[model samples]
Target: MGNITGFMEHQKVPLHYRDPMERIKDWNEIATLPTEEILREQASRCMDCAVPFCQDGTQLAGMTTGCPVYNLIPEWNDLVYKGRWKEAYHRLSRTNPFPEFTGRACPAPCEGGCVATLATDSVTIKNIERAIIDKAFEEGWVQPNIPKHRTGKKVAVIGSGPAGLACASVLNQHGHQVTVYERADRIGGLLTYGIPKTKIEQYVVDRRIRLMEEEGIAFVTNTEVGKQLQMDQLHSENDAVILCIGSTRPRDLNIPGRNQKGIHFAMDYLHQNTKSLLDSNFADEEFINAEGKDVIVIGGGDTATDCVTTAVRQNCKSLVQFDIYPIRPTKRAEDNPWPQYPVIHKVDTGQEEAKHVFGNDPRAFATTAQGFTSDKYGNITGVKSVNIKTKFNEKGEKIRDIVPGTEKIWSAQLVLLAIGFSGPETGLIKQTKVALNNQSNIKVKKDTFQTDEEGIFAAGDARTGASLIVWAIQEGKEAAMECHHYLMRNVS
Candidate 1:
């Protein structure tokens, strides 16, 4: 517990972010480093709730509430309040291998479940955790201490994303020889490529990768396991295989003119933009520029907000985002009480940036794209959209109905589809002949991460559908434990 009277005396003061206009001018992190004194006050706001539901990650009414990684929020908050940053960092890293990433991109369900939020503003757990880890890095305390004893059993991890990275890091700490294979030119799959530099700087990822390498985790970049390398080689080389390739195949727009140029998936646009920025500055790159063009983004998630904000930074003449579903309320509904995910609408950092620059929220609720218009050379010119209404059927499944006479056209020279993903690509699964669940996700027994193939396991988006980063980290840790047990059985 913090100061007995701290919760009453101090209010929750979170991190400060750069002004929208200033941030849109370049690719830098939005959150400004708040003073340590303010962060300490924020940490002291943690109330003496008898049952701290913040760490009890649970799914209720088809929605997740609280921290998915089950982080020790109370413990860490107390540590930060007491100025024990090293202890706070250790407790945070004990559960979440990479607090730096989650501290940046995560939605922070822990905040939602904070009992203080029910009456007063919640403690700033996310910001406090971020500060602790950053302080650890500054003090040069974050070093890779390789296991003293080697198990001599080799393991091949078939991805370098969060899940794979977490699994590899944990397994390596457990004394296994781990080789991480990444298809991309560099490590940190989504963290490096999919996530824009505006959200998370690439060097943050680079630092973690350097530590992993120093810890004896072998990272082979630009090496596609199923394509460039064979599954047969992986099977023979490693004692266990952990597949964490992620759900990469984007959900597509089957409507007319989808094949037209300038209409691309969100990840492709983000990836190309990041690569171009890394190679040179945005001014030098002509490809994927939204300058002076009408931009349209389709989807209503973090990714769509990113598209909108990115286009704003690109100085698009105008921008509009469409969500197929209706808008959410500003406050929780009567039925959705405490300990449930607050599904009410709140502006994300990107939306806030767009609002500051564009004078309004760019998202259009209850709208869906019908088709696209193209120029003679197949460059996108405009987009056709229609309003839609949603209702539940007899089977209790929600369905969308396009409203009649609501069709409209908007000039959109650039269209980005951020409709989310279906599942992982079929190339690796097809080649390996792994069994898939009905949802096209890799099938594995619950709790135990073992796939049908003995000594082979699956975790993260490949096991579950598109999910939160915290869940992926948890899955990776659990799978490593199960894999450890399976590997030990062979030795004994």
Candidate 2:
């Protein structure tokens, strides 16, 4: 508690974003850093509550309420307030391996659980976190933590996303030989390709990868475990294997005219655009182009928002996003009390950018795509949609029913389905013969990350389905600890 009354003295200072119109013209990060003085004042706002729910990382009402990685929020905030940024970074990094990625992408459940938020706005924990790390990098405080001795235990991590990277990071720090296998052409998995450059620049990801490489963790890109390298060979070579391959199966909207040429999966669209943008700055014309097209993004989530913003940057003529569920109230409902992730409506950056470009918010709530209307060339010309009302069944399950006579068609040249993912792709799972849960995720014992197969474990979305980056990191770290204990006990 650097400043006991800091929360009363300082008002929350929100992070600024670059002008939306100007930012849409290029593919750079939109967030602008706060001044050092402003950041310090913001950090001072941490009341350092007795319970400190911000770092509790508890699950309430079936939703995350705090930092999933259990970041020492108040400690770091006090350190930052006292101008000890390097120490703050060290404290922040004690739990979270990659603050940069989470700083940019995470929804910051910590703020929602902040004690200050009960009375007023919460402290700017996310911005303070990012500032501490950014300052650490600038001051040359960030460096590779090479292990002092080799445990000689080899671990193979499949997938180079946050989960894989965090697992490999911890195992390597424990003196184990860690190797990451990424099926993509480059490392960082979704962090590298799935997320747009505007949210988290590729260079930020590259910087961490470089540090990891320097710390003796080897990354093999363009090599898939089930295909290029035999799964049996991987199991035979590595002492233990951790599957961090995230849920890759995208949920599809099956309806009439589904075979249209312009209708593409959201990941396909985002991945190709990022690949091409990094390859030749999109000069090669290798990615999907949305220029002068009426784009309709199906499913309202982060991916749908990304698609909407990406289409706007591509100079799309118009845009609209469909949400099958009804819009959430601006204020939390009676059932959604404080510290439950606050199920309320809020505009994300993509929708903000869309509004700036299209003169209105692009989201149409309680609406679903009924079918696709295609032109003679088999290209998407428009989307037929209908209003829906949600009702709960006797079993407490929600059901969506279309409102009669509310069908309408919205012109759309391109349709991107961002509904979400089903589970890890079946190819690798089948090749490895791992048992899957009812939801198609890898089945693992509670607190024990080991799967059905011996010496094999699963973490992240591979086991938990699609989730936040913070949760994935936490799972990866937990899986690494369990795997380490198992190897020490049995392998040797």
Candidate 3:
């Protein structure tokens, strides 16, 4: 520890956020930078434990407890404390290729595992990371580290999400020619579109992508591997292929009035709204406008939270979210103790904004949508719902049992289904001829990310099914290693 007494002297300080009332009026980032002095104090609080669980990415109680990318937390913390910020940036970037994205969007498992948090507050690791990277960018130290030698072999990554990008980044550093293909007009798959600009500014993603391009990684945008471009072409042209397309096939609600005009999938609604905002500022095309309308969102997760906040910004007259599971306790239960990811109920940014505006929490736990009601002209007029209980059926499959006399009706001109995804689109999977596991994910060995086809591999959501961004990045790095071995074995 640089200062042995630092942990005792300093208390944890969180980054400031804009006032809810003012921030809800626009789609801008809510987090504000802490002053330099506050950040310095926070950086000094690192206890520098012998084990350093904060930097060790491990699973306990079936949840992640530390940085999945294994960032050198103490090294960077000491560097920051010693007034060596450029070196801190270098150390931070050594393991995490994209700190800016994780700095903004990641849930910061590192903080949860902080040794300080065992008794007192955790060090502000995420904020420190953000500050280090931002300083690096401002000082022009955040440039592409282009490899000095070429490996002569070429690799094509089929998606540009965190997994695909991380794979390409590591491979490029190893002197391999890497090309990233994204079907969207812009790079950074979910980072660019699925997530809103308020949480992570699109410009940040663009900036990183630009740096990667400068490092000699080619990005081919607006090209689909199965439709616009043939899979056979990809197979023949590239030395190897890595699939990181992500689990994009959304789960849908199949019920009465499901075909109503205003009812839409959550990702579709979020993606279209983003595209509309980016394309014409909502001038040319019509959006699933929540302005002055009663909106009902189905499901309870990050995407559901995004819908609530997005609709609030759209000036929705009212909003309601349905959660089928029982409400979680405020603190970890006796059955779930320390070091486990706390499965406690907490107000997310969007729900907090909703509560501020609506005079109550918008989420209704143990509730589910029964069906949608439509107006005379077939627009969504409201949603029908009821309380439900979960039970095991004869076949051992989980079933939902609707409670009698618990039916409720809520006014809703728009209904958004945020029920998560199934797997990658079948079009590409079917055409590529890669085998799938029982869960329908790409069949790959536990540690190795290779597929049945030689010189081809898979990673990210495509390989692991629906997963967190951190896991996807880890898989990408491992897959890159497998690809490296495959290439070296064949290349002269």
Models 1 onward score TM values of 0.97, 0.98, 0.95
Q: In order, what lDDT does every prediction score?
A: 0.87, 0.91, 0.87
Task: Identify the runs in model 1 with alpha carbons over 4 angstroms from their true place.
Answer: 283-287
Local accuracy of candidate 3 as per-residue lDDT tens digits, 1-492: 787568899888898888989998777788888888888778889887878878877788667888889999999998888778999999998888888888888878888788887677788998999999999999999988999999998999999999999999989988999999999998999998898888888889999999999999999999999999888788888899999999998999988999988888898888878888778877866577898999999999889999998898888999999999878998778976656666789888899899999988999999999888898899889899999988778987889888999999899988999998888887877777688888888888666888877778999999888777877888789899889888888566
Candidate 1 backbone collisions, by pair: none
Instruction: List candidate 3 stretches off by more than 4 Å.
Output: 389-404
Worst 10 residues of 1 by lDDT: 278-287
Residues 1-492, model 2: lDDT tens digits: 889889899888898999998999999999977999999899989986788889978789778889999999999999989999888999998999999998888989998899887887888888888888888889999999999999889999999999999999999998899999999999999999999999899989999999999999999999988999988899999999999999999998889999998999999999999999999999999999999999999998889999988999999999999988788998879998888888889899999999998899999999999899987889789999999999999998889888999999999889999999999987887877688999988998765789989989999999999999899999999999998887788544
Stronger candidate by lDDT (1 vs 3): 3
Q: Residue-pair clashes per candidate, as listed? A: 0, 0, 0
* Model 3: residue 312 alpha-carbon error in angstroms: 1.0
Full-model lDDT, candidate 2: 0.91
Candidate 3, poorest ten consecutive residues by summed lDDT: 335-344
